[model samples]
Target: MLNAIVIGGGLAGSQAAIYLADNNVKVKLYEMRPNKTTGAHTSSDFAEFVCSNSLGAQSVTSASGLLKEEARLLGSKLIEEAYNNRVPSGNSLSIDRWGFSKKITQIIENHPNIEIIREEITQLPKTPTIVATGPLTSDSLCSEIKKLTGEDNFHFFDAVAPIVKKETINFEKAFYASRWDKGNADFINCPLNKDEYENFYNILTTAEKIPLKSFEAKYFEGCMPIEVIASRGFDTLRFGPMKPVGLFDKRTREEHHKNYQFYAVVQLRQDDKQADLYNLVGFQTNLKWGEQKKLINSIPALENAQIVRYGVMHANTFINSPKILNKTLQTKFNPNLFFAGQITGVEGYSESIATGLFAGINMLRHLRGEKLLELEAKCMLGALLEYITFANHKAFQPINSNWGIVEKPQEVEKLKKKSKEEKGALLSNIALEYIKEIRNGYFC
Candidate 1:
């Protein structure tokens, strides 16, 4: 007789279920794996980490660490179990994959208010539901989601360029300008001479690439990875993504006076409203992270770039959250329905859990006819949700929990000349204090 249903027992779904069950809300948790497996999953366990065994750094100075601390403050069941089932990983919260999965499975199956259902939910239920089906969501449910959100808002593949914190990008070597000076000076242009272009080109062509999974083998001609384009020929990238056509570097041109002209240029577009983050304009890549760092560093403008999210070209199923969901993770189309996890355009283990944990709390509130929590952007989890819900929909991409996403608290804004670690510690302190206030004030 449970009216509340949580679909797809992944990280987000599982966290949502646990939070709701702990609050005495009977939850029917559904898992589709072992009955209908995804391309990545190897087991039927709830909260199974499909990718990395390491969650992230456990130090509060790190972004993932701040999220975990806030989750701990909010009594997150998954975060507690992650630590309890953790293995030796130094400062990183790494765990024994099998043991962690089994522990989580045991907990979910034994929870008194939870009903473990071994089935696939193809249809979105009319009753209150949280669709945390994740990136590898099933075809049928994908279809249902597509119908609910429309085809334009749903994406089956992720072709994303690396995003860098604007503060880290060496502006001395880069200048903001629009192509042909036709629009606002919106693009950060990194002008590369012949030597720099060739050097970047050589490294990119030889970089290690992650072979697409069997299910993700299909490559669209127009949207091939940057590495693939480089492999075609030496001049391919110069004419393509790295093209310098119409980009008149007015700043450097004024300094050099017609002596400086770019052989090729790399462009970065403003990714956030704050303009604090910018993404490589056409740098959608599948290169290994090590190689990505090497190639990005070769560019003069990106010599010391701090990549917030790396370029990822993978078979992923995520909705355009800014277009479809509120900051509460509830869909704009249906108030009774909610979404969390990778499907909500949030990447990483802790981030998925944060969304699910919040959705669960908000779902319970929704059932009780109370105002849902739209956590303030000062908190790590709140900032992530705010980004997904309010980011530009035209180029919305999945993001992990990164310091670049968190807003500076007004109190922190007053203080200046602090080291990066010190600034991060200050932000973490603000987030923890904010979450603690919510935990104390909220009834559920």
Candidate 2:
């Protein structure tokens, strides 16, 4: 019987361990929590979502959605669990955070072929291993990784948005609507008129922020703090996160103002099955506690909003993947070792699951003395791996799943199409065919 060591119990490690265990391999899954917790996590549960509850858009025409569909085709264990515990967020796949983590912890703890080890691993094991420690990797292990991959691994800070109680939001000013009314009216919107928006922007830009510690460098472009974004200009927030296009205020419409539109809107996405908690959409911040409360209260309907959790920032680290890893996620010089998740430079929850699935499948092939497998670059998953493992080494950075990484087939490229949704649909169809071929030619 083949046995493997899996390090860290975040999304990627848990998914990899489950995949290997289901395939009849024994897995020792190490989670350094409860005894040694990352500052962001509140539980010892595997696959805890420390950031926003969203898994991004869930339509095939969207890049994140396409990546998720590909993961589903590959039988990603976490994606199944996420869907099982989903909370409404229009077309995006958001889950009941606590329920989702509980289910994943239960599954990992109960697996027959898996052993849950509750201890921090200070050094990488010599046995066949998968390192999915994620961005908040501990200092000692990070040092060890640096020794192996050189001292040039990159670091940046990521912030989490605040969560508020649903009851505190005033319904008189807030209404439910999704962008372009494309899906169910699942998102709660707080409308701000031109004057209200201008006042909010002034206070936001002038609000005091928490200074980063000496170790934390620049913020990741994807998760820049709301205040940092506000500092760009007077109209930056209006055009960026607070853009109110493609949405109508139900209250205003009911009040006989058919053509009325707000200057800006703040969105709140449901974060739990009970609908009692909602996270501020695109409101990640590192402001001081007092400043956060003042800024939040300044919003039209959120004057008395009860904050369940405050926004925070933490250092994110990633390996220099192009120089250290192969497309199969194996260390180029040490074939028995592998990496996954944000630690290997793939961002977003769904992207982490994809890398975990690939690492698990490839590890199994390695054990059986078979040729290590890699997906064709025509697919999103393959393209993401190809970029991380083969992109220019000197300019490496963490990346989320996007269609830009995917290499387009000639037919789509020849048509001179600029629509992302159109290109995504064409790529989605081709990727599905590749999935069918992979199933028939390999796993079958």
Candidate 3:
């Protein structure tokens, strides 16, 4: 029997292990926590949710949601477990962090073909292995990865958002609505008039920011700190992430007010199924907790805001995927070895799980002496794999799954009258059908 070793028991590693074991492959899963630790994780459990419990949008029309559905159809262990433990949070799939991790750990431990090993792995195994060490990978393994992939191939630093408990929010001043009637009005909009926006902007610009450690200075472009966005220019944020276009306040019903479209708007997205918490949309920051509360509360709607968690920035690590791996997620240098999750440069929980499933499926193919499965680019999961393996090597950065990366149908593009969501739904349906075909073959 072929044996597979999966390093790091985070979301990616756990998923990889489960899929491999389910296929009748013997697997060893290694986790370095409780023995050693990262700056982000607090528990020793496998697949720990370090930041937020919410996985992302739950609508099939949204890219994140569509990815989740794709994962579900593929019999993704992580998504299945998450769904069963899901809490109510509007249209997003959120889980209890502690409960989620505990459940995953239990399942992996109970699997007959899988063995859990607790120790810090300083070196890679020469035998077949999958590296899904995620962003907060330990220092020693990172160095080993650097030697194998080359110095310029790895990265470190992640901009994270603060999670707030639902009970803490002052709902009297907040209202829920998706922008322009999109996605079931799933987001909570915190409206700001001209004066309120200016006041909040001023505080944000002047508030104290958490300084980067001497060793970690450069920030990833994709996950820039909110303070960095503010420093670019006063209106920089307004034009960038905090832009208030496409949203109309039903309470105000003043769509064309011209001047007060919103000096700015801070959106809080539902973080769990239970609506017990909301994450500040596009508000990832490195501000001190006190400063975050002081500055964030300056907004009119958040004057009485209560913070359950504060935004933090941490060092994230990844490999130069385009130069190292094939679409099957196996390393070019070693066919027996595979890579998955953030370490492979794909971002977000769903993206990580997709890579894990791909690695798992391909690993099974290798063991069974069958041809590897290479999905079509039209599929979202397939497109993500293609992107990581084929994006420009020098400019390749970690990417979250987005519609912009998916291969668009020519028929959809030609229709100018269709809304973006309309086109997205059509493409999503096609992708799901393709995934179903893949699943049918595997399940039978």
**CA RMSD for every model?**
12.6, 1.5, 3.0
Better of 1 and 2 by lDDT: 2
Question: For model 2, which pairs clash?
Answer: none
Better of 1 and 2 by TM-score: 2
lDDT of 2 at 162: 94
Q: Per-residue lDDT of 287-308 in model 2, one digit per residue for the tens?
A: 8888889889999899999999
Compose the digit string of candidate 1's lDDT tens values, residues 163-244.
7888988888998776667646767889888889889988998899877656535443445678877888988887898888
Index of the highest-TM-score prediction? 2
Q: Least lDDT summed over 10 consecutive residues: which range in candidate 2?
A: 250-259
Quality of model 3 by C-alpha lDDT: 0.81
Instruction: Give candidate 3 regions above 4 Å deviation.
Output: 89-91, 181-187, 214-222, 239-241, 245-262, 272-275
Winning model by lDDT: 2
Pairs with steric clashes in candidate 1: none
The parts of candidate 1 lying over 4 Å away from their true place are 151-314, 391-393, 414-416
Cα lDDT of model 2 overall?
0.89
Q: By the TM-score metric, which is better: model 2 or model 3?
A: 2
The total number of steric clashes, by the backbone 3 Å criterion, in model 3 comes to 14
